[model samples]
Target chain A: MGRTTFHTDPVEALAGVADGDTVLVGGFGMAGMPVRLVDALIDVGAKGLTIVSNNAGNGETGLAALLKAGRVAKVICSFPRQADSYVFDGLYRAGEVELEVVPQGNLAERMRAAGAGIGAFYTPTGVGTLLAEGKEQRTIDGRDHVLEMPIRGDWALIAAQAADPMGNLVYRKTARNFGPVMATAAATTVVEVRETVDLGAMDPEAVVTPGIFVDRVVTS
Target chain B: MTAQQGLPLDVSGAAEHPEPLDRAGLAARVARDVPAYAYVNLGIGQPTTVADHLDPAQGVVLHTENGMLGMGRAAHDDEVDPDLINAGKVPVVEPPGASYFHHADSFAMMRGGHLDVCVLGAFQVSAAGDLANWHTGAPDAIPAVGGAMDLAIGAKQVFVMMSLFAKDGSPKIVPSLTYPATGLACVDRVFTDLGVFAVDHERGRVVLLEAYGTTAADLAERLTGA
Candidate 1:
């Protein structure tokens, strides 16, 4: 309805996030993670948060740091345990954190479904595995598929290589993982970028995520 | 030589028996089967070793679940790109013509059955071709089931890389799986330290295709306890 505002301060951009809210942090391992936004969230000290991401971060960088600060109450991710994910491992083993292990494909689809306004969908990804336990099942075209619900977040923290004045974003290389899907799946999407340019500076053809899905942009 | 040409068996010692191939040997055996121009996805663990054994001239393209196609071998300390890692979170190199996409699109490639073959590590594979490798359901087990389920059912052909027997000498290829199942009748072939098995899902039987250090008869006997 109005022009998007760019915040130079990460905390001011992420001030809308409250405690005990579902937050989606976009990244695959350490790449594409909103590090500055995460650090800002740490400064905000929002506790009892639910984090959804591809990983639990390798070390105390992004999601791992939030967990180490005793902010995260649960983590829903594809891979929660890595060689350097000692923070999650220790907290999980000590019964301090809850975890929901979703298959990578299903995780992406769930987020995409939420963004697309799809209520639910059936996928053959985890049909006969433990991930299918207690979920609805059906046979379609003589193949087994498990029903998965859409995943929506109260807020989404994303990282992009460049952002236009209107909040249109572009990501670099493999670092683009989960950024687009998450940009649309959250109630409020805040993006961290290296730089921002004029509205007409970016070619429409090169825009991966339109400004319609983004709420705020912060340059770090 | 191909794995079909079984290794020599020691006959001088009456009590000495043939030793199974080590992890590298098993990986080489799997790598030799990858056809040229094939788009392959190598799972974590032992299956990743297949990439190292593959001939660079084979033209085989590697795919990682995190969304990179045309992936190359594991990166060295100096070449490691922190942002470029495989599904295992291990650093990797991007081969020529490599492309990266969104996570959803990558899964679409896998679930849409665009890959020619996917090599995965397994705990147990039944004679009927059922695979169970994700979780053992042990209290101490973390139950991290990354992309194995998608790869197991989505790949055009699934090849499992594991040892013929567990550390306790119990056969991993059994008449029926004792652990939780990952996929039903999805496994096409299994490469083990001892031999390769072609699963006849229609007949619910396993056929020994090749062996490393033992005769087919001896391996069959060990498999069926004849």
Candidate 2:
């Protein structure tokens, strides 16, 4: 059993988390992501965090805040674009922020696996070369597979269009990236929704993440 | 490695069949200069051509930021495997013992300083080794920067390939840059249609390393001011 609490300040609720935590963020390139929460964490000076996002947003907008603050230690991402003020590049060259670049398709699957409670899965993603190094390789039906592990987070910070008292979430447009998976993967899921709705007010199928997977709900 | 026979220049006009050089020759030239066993990231466009000319017999290992190792050049139509593609989303072939990975983990490798060399295409590269290839804001332009930034900063050595001059005879390599920099002072070597040059860091000048048939003065004339 777990205890629940509420706060008017999202930062106060998030401040309970410690440093060096792995945080799964929901959003696609500047889409539906927890921008405010990310900024709050940066303002609080959280360091050594392993950040998982689709793409670090344009400079001064999304994950770039945390990146510019030099609080992120490692980044697990799909595409590393430069128009983002080259902040990622500067960190990379300085050996400050470690990076793991993944293919877009595999990134989705890895997040999906975490949400499914699978600890590890095998695929043909990386089998022959350096990616295969130190990884378990198996042949399935005359084909080779490279073993990959699911990525879960201590907390999943997500942004949603609406949420209820019980934490049912609905995303708007492109802001839904990896949100559902991240919601299920983390032990505690914290969300920042645009609108707070009464429980049972929303339709069933429209809710992407159920209240049970989510531990806390923060509305902005 | 064998020397490529130069293409005979057209005396009549600037247009000639095949432009006197095949893709293989270009690939070979790019591959010849890269040191063996160096972790290499091949950029999209012409830079991918190096994979074809790589003498794997020389022990060069190619890496795709998309989580592929032991990568080879673009596969022939008959050998094409749709599932296997480079970052550019073009079908490619994987050499023996090639491995795939979660895209995130692949980026980790690059950010971890494991890559030794990154070869990329460029719209312009200053004598100071600054690169700007992603966007010109031109109409019909596919606005993108892709992994060029990561590759530029992550790799130990940055190599650029491009024409010395734009179509309008405007020099792409200049004393200083006009466009946004991809990576500041990160480029180590450059290969152009005219020749190869390296950064003379302290002097802020480009040092001529090789010229196909052009002189250092002519190269400097185009790359630097009088």
Candidate 3:
């Protein structure tokens, strides 16, 4: 079989993921959340996962359900508390899971760094806040900057609007948030698309994630 | 605090105590100041309503921190799309020239000084323009900073919208922030129901630009101890 497979079932697409893998799950709130892939990963029952995402979980679905199942050991995200993020909030307060809070921009940039092979970079975000504690600080022309390291992922689970058979992906509207960057940061990026388009159907210039970044895609 | 007493109080246009600006009134005031051909980001809660007051001809583009620019009005009934939403998670539509990018690129636009202005709701802003809005530092509270830190320091001009006082009548504008800080010396202006104050971080002062129900001298004296 070719390296990139378009699976009919997301479970099969996620079959190789093992326990304790650092997974980067895309989405802000429910938008662009790979629910099928998350559900499959849930059924796969891999535990101690380190999930990097925007929100920890919402309501009783997607990442929340994954958190509810006790599969995640640590959550490295920008924002974890929300009106319906009870699952993660509960688990976090109970001291059952570790939490690492990062500024939203830093969260995205760190992953972009991992993908682009940047060793480390100084960022103005979170320079003096509690989040910047213990990090090296530099004054560049009198402006404060903090050293931030790259965040790599073993698996990136993302959602897309459409995908071509060769694996180039495009997402709908604001749902494209971290999907493009996450795809490049992971060793294996798994995507779930609503539909698969023929190769020529997708505009070459419009492809948000090139085929090289994608490892698997399941039509959900 | 040193410049408070000597500051000139403009009493030329005074009603002694004109009625304070309501939500719609405050939004209108902030909208008037949005420069033409500017890219703006409105924070969640009170700041979001400022979008409604914006005029299209002014070439003011709305930037939703979630990953959109040139954001349009809210989606109703048939127009709602789960994938198309604003920073507040409310369904929205894209304008004709709307653009979308990934989170990194989106945030880069903010931190890189590409945005013209960003309106936000604050818990407190000191005379030195120190911002304290992200967290209360309450032990039991679940902290969620979201994009507050990024937007606070990123925008070219940071305007804060809030009631003049807390629910208990305590002033939200203080000499120093007791609440945890979001960013240091980042806020440029404070738009309140009572008045508008400009923060001069260099001189460490809060100057009254306009007053609603209060006069400059009275608010200034209060600012010293408030």
Candidate 4:
């Protein structure tokens, strides 16, 4: 019945992440990225990590910075080759990094399934594409679907606009893209919020992620 | 200027080599065929241009897989909101009554057959209506499929926008695709710079519905030939 504690330092909030850990980062491109936590992970120098996100991040920011630092061994993302994802491109070409390119819808569902404690689910997203290669396929109700396993992370770093002392979070605009789903799919969820208020400050209905799923909160 | 005005204008020579429609022209032609009040998704590259040519009165809703519905046209440099972007990661404005949801929900709208039409760019489209656009699988190419596969299969009607020929003069519409398939029997129509084609999946043939600067017979020959 104890409440979740907030961390004043980003490094301390991300202390649980270690080398070879799988980290789920919440964002769509640059939006909703937990900048401070990402910076903290870079500072901590966790190596050979598996990073999951939507994009590789535009320019040298967020996940790109992590990849540029050579801390990531692999990246699982939908849009891994954006106009500005030169970091991933360079590493991938040099055989220094690996990439698992999942379809956007499948990516979101896999993460959701992880949080929901589901083993796996069938999706029609990548049926005939390269993404469907080697994956199990089944015909359901006269249609084809590919079986995708749940995607879980050792730690999840997410961003939010506001949070209460109990760790309930509310995100801003499109910034909320992967935050809620990533929060559930991780063993430990650390949220970076702009502001922290009292327990009841966030309206119960407005909270997208309940406090029970979060383990730490950091003000960025 | 006076000498040019008095010339015969080389009209016969001009007719010998008709120019294909430009990118915007191709998009506008595709826009003309989009049904009114339809909910549509536009894939990146040439297909995104359809948003610019759509009639404002048509009430077509643009859905972005990154969690936005009722998205507006591309935003100007000054109006760019970094956080507000389409699935392609390009900045865009949102029209009134626009709603944002979780990424999963936005995808559900796409995969659950709620979209009326999806316009996409293809590397190659088979005569049997199969689509292949995600990757060429070249040695140097970075494979990033994104949402093209989902939109290809889930949308009620899949419309493709692409050039009729590759830069090497290879026909993009062929009897069978050389590239990997994105979806099977998914495409209903294709709008290329040369013409608009209706794919007859059952017969494994593509019928030229309209031509811009080329004749149907010439286009068909090109498509049917090696």
Where does model 2 sit among the CAPRI classes? incorrect
Using TM-score, give the best candidate's number.
3
Candidate 4 docks with a DockQ of 0.65
| Segments in model 4 whose C-alpha atoms lie over 4 Å from true places | B1-19
Name model 3 segments beyond 4 Å from true.
Answer: B1-17
Sorted by DockQ (best first), the order is 3, 1, 4, 2
Ranking by lDDT: 3, 1, 4, 2
RMSD of each: 5.3, 15.0, 2.7, 7.1
Q: Write the per-residue lDDT of candidate 1 for residues B1-226, one digit (tens) a residue.
A: 3222322222222221266678888888899999988999998887888988888799898888887998877789799877788877788787779998888898888889998999998889987788999888788777777888888889999999998888887678877777888888899998887778788777777777767677666766666665
Candidate 3 per-residue C-alpha lDDT over A57-114 given as tens digits, one digit per residue, 9 for 90 to 100:
9989899999999999999998898888999999998999899988899899999999
Pick by lDDT: which candidate is best? 3
- Between prediction 3 and prediction 4, the one with superior DockQ is 3
Cα lDDT over the full model 1: 0.85
Choose 2 or 4, whichever is better by TM-score: 4
- Model 1 agreement with the true structure over A1-220: per-residue lDDT tens digits: 3365689999999887888999999988777889999889999988999999988877777788889999999999988878899989999999999999998888999999999999999988887777889999999999988999999999999999899978898887778889999999999999999888776899999999999989999986
DockQ of 2: 0.05
Q: Model 4: which docking level applies?
A: medium
* Candidate achieving higher lDDT, 3 or 4: 3
lDDT by residue for model 4 over A1-220, one digit each (tens)?
Answer: 2377788899998886889999999988877889999989999888999999988766897788899999999989887888888988999999999999888888888999999989999987778777889999999999899999999999999998888877888887678898999999999999999998786668998888899989999975
Interface C-alpha root-mean-square deviation of candidate 4: 1.3
| Candidate 2, position A118, lDDT | 78
